[model samples]
Target: MNAQAVRNYSNEFLNIGVDAAALGMSRSVVATTNDVNAVYWNPAGLVNIEDYQGSIMYASYFAGIANYNYAAFAMPIDKQSALGVSLIRFGVDDILNTTELIDSQGNIDFNRVSLFSAADYALTVSYAKNLIFKDLYFGVNAKVVRRTIGKFANSWGFGFDAGIQYERDDWKFGLMVRDITTTFNIWNIDEDAFATIQGAIPGQNQELPETTEITKPKVQFGMARKFDIGRTFHLLTEVDLNLRFARTNDIISTGLGSIDPAIGFQLDYENFVFLRAGVGNFQKTTEFDGSKSLSVQPNFGVGFTYKGIQVDYALTNIGSIGNALFSNIFSVKIDYSFFRR
Candidate 1:
């Protein structure tokens, strides 16, 4: 926590980002057959669903001003081609901004509230395609991000991710590289920077503050697989191996010299209902004290489909503070059959 801690108004959920159902019960939906939630988790899973399907989820968790919300829509292009789009918003509220200055008596004073609340948002476009043999599939996604920090300034950037999934039969395999070309620049950035925001000093020369920009990292490589138990039940599992070249030396970062690994799983019932769960770092030492390094207690979730719409929900234990409820993920998906002669 010491090395990877954000000091400003950053939306952590957008990065550690999870679908409403996944975030609940500790986020263990990786290996399950919930391709609907995979858009936010893995884009390759898009081709697994029916044609012209879309999903939306709204969460009321984290208690205070923090929020997590997202939506995803995916459709098959012919038989081997598929496309999708998603939007995610994470942020906090009620922030107090003030300026420091010197009074006539040489005492320190502060300016009034400069701004109100701040947030971060990501707009993403993703596409996927299946190979001729029916065992290999590929996917890619592009994202535009916006971030605001108090009186400092706002920054914007563009990023890209690519992935591939291979499955011979009932056993399915998945793999992806996240943030392959993630690039961020401080909006209206300059060397003099925030120095102009300075005020008069007691008796010394004029002083100006210095501000800097930080760049997001490009995490690489994640692997997953799903097993079918005959026809009624199924099991899904995955492991992510992330390595960032510019992680510690990035512009906007904590400068930590380390790698993060995560593992998770899911269970499906009748292909229409799902019970999912997972465990990983980042938030592990958090909820479950003395839990497994990767276990972090347990993550569980369930989802069902009726008509053409699907709804997935999870259960998390709060223990005392009335239980910190996360969010729910919902979507309308379609799966079509196209067999060649």
Candidate 2:
């Protein structure tokens, strides 16, 4: 089978929580993150955090049909080290299960029209410190993931991520490896609960879904440069290369394999306002005529900061895939420098 046919994976929620700024920049923050959100982007950037930092974010996705939320807190352990924790939740609520049941007389049963919820959540504990070498940093993230469907079925998984960063003058570089141990999801389905589903429809025969899925590791390398146009205005440009691997076969039929490149730009006015834009997720898709074409998505966002509080918003275009309006993302961050060095 081709890679596309066998591309079954689970726990995709791990990729849903993009901070507002990063989302605005089309997730081009791998080499530019410098706050609590670093825990989700490039943990190595955490070392740049001065004292204590916290972030909270929420987005109403898919026209409010679903939602995503994130929160993170980081504190310096010492002059050269820091610890952080992050949580993410993505789910849909009150979905009406329209599967109906009929009585002996073929009468409709209202009880069968129930509601259920499906949710995915993850918790990540991260640690970062400056490397022995100057201007270098390293970090790691330990994560636990859970997915549930109103209790009928649940899955649990664990994964870890590691990253390294180096900075020289106004240039920054980063390398991140996600799912370093090859994450796996073990699913447990309640047969008894599902038995009712089978009995509801006399001629229906349903089989249990797969119990496990393994997600391979992915690597991202990024570079960014900051231009101090003036003491009050600055520009940051970044590019990231993403690579996906497969177990035995080539990741994709394309000789280029699973490689995607993303680029972003951010403009800042002093420390008060920000503007960002980016394009990413480059890929080749077969057209109806059996011809392949290149495609990508464009995104943009804006932000404002005052005192120690910051707010950011982004609009991410899903292109023709979603057949809907752009996704709206937002986030807030606060830094407490009470113990600043």
Candidate 3:
């Protein structure tokens, strides 16, 4: 499997949430700099900013996937305690639908005409504090989701995220687990939909047709180190391991064990701007072909923070195609934060 082939999504909801148009395309992962999304990318990063700051992020991705939006606020509750809140939203525009069905005349008749869309949002609250030797941050997220199609409800589910971050003199380490105890039950599921599925003969009541939400285990563990190579210049290196466990009907994509590792290096100049370029095995480093190849192997990014504003951009490959995944393969991200006493 190509490094880029390493993929995981807890809920099917993510299928519609992952967009190519969004920034951070370099790795098909969320972009984090100075925004509330840091709460998701890595809650420990939330403490890197000022004591009291508020931020917002907006990412438009996948020509039609969605508009990913995030907002957050962090405050110092006391000398050793800090609290924060963040929100994330993803969804699509309305869609037109017209399914063909046989009418009473044994001819095709499409009577149901409707428009619908699917979207999901999650809210998180985080906290960080210093331990006996260094900084230790613990955070949790609560999410409520709803999915619908036309006049019928598709499914709805709830999930949570917990993470811990630790920092020392020259390194930073963090761990996170997401999507714990999640389920989906759609609204108004017509019994006819399951009349025949998976080669099962029609049955009068094997069980109520309920929404089946996708569930998976996701974990992220990583370390980042800083080095002083020259005067007024710094080098930052980061390596992370991600594992995903999930059961899916999609055979090729289903399984419970897959390991993904990512590494990146950035050169900082004058404590203001950074020139970054690194290659990581996103999914798999090689492919089924007989030769070694990099699928989504290159990550090039540039970021700078001046005053109260910060912006970053990165480029990657959705695949080796010159179409939408090529030219639009680049992602640009902008974040704004306000500091208050």
* Highest-scoring model, TM-score: 2
TM-score of 1: 0.68
Can you write out model 1's per-residue Cα lDDT over 1-341, one digit (the tens) per residue? 01222222232345555554565435433333236556666677677766566666655455545665677777777677778888887666676544444444757566633454566778888877777767677778887777665545566756677777776554555555556654443353332424434432234444332233334454434556667888788876766544444333122233453354556666778767777776543332233454433223345577776565556675443211224444333333433222211
User: For candidate 3, lDDT tens digit of each residue in 124-176?
Assistant: 67665555655776656666665554443465666676667776778777776
Error of 2 at 238 (Å): 0.5
List of clashing residue pairs for candidate 3 = 2-284, 3-283, 3-284, 3-285, 4-283, 6-283, 20-62, 21-61, 21-62, 22-61
Candidate achieving the largest lDDT = 2
Q: Kindly report the root-mean-square deviation of model 1 from the true structure over all alpha carbons.
A: 7.5
Stretches off by above 4 angstroms in model 2 are 1-8, 103-105, 199-205, 246-256, 317-322, 338-341
On lDDT, who's better, 1 or 2? 2
RMSD of 2: 3.8
The global C-alpha lDDT for each of the candidates, from Candidate 1 onward, is: 0.55, 0.81, 0.52
Q: In model 2, how large is the Cα lDDT of residue 211?
A: 74
Report the Cα RMSD per candidate. Answer: 7.5, 3.8, 7.2
Clashes of each: 13, 0, 10
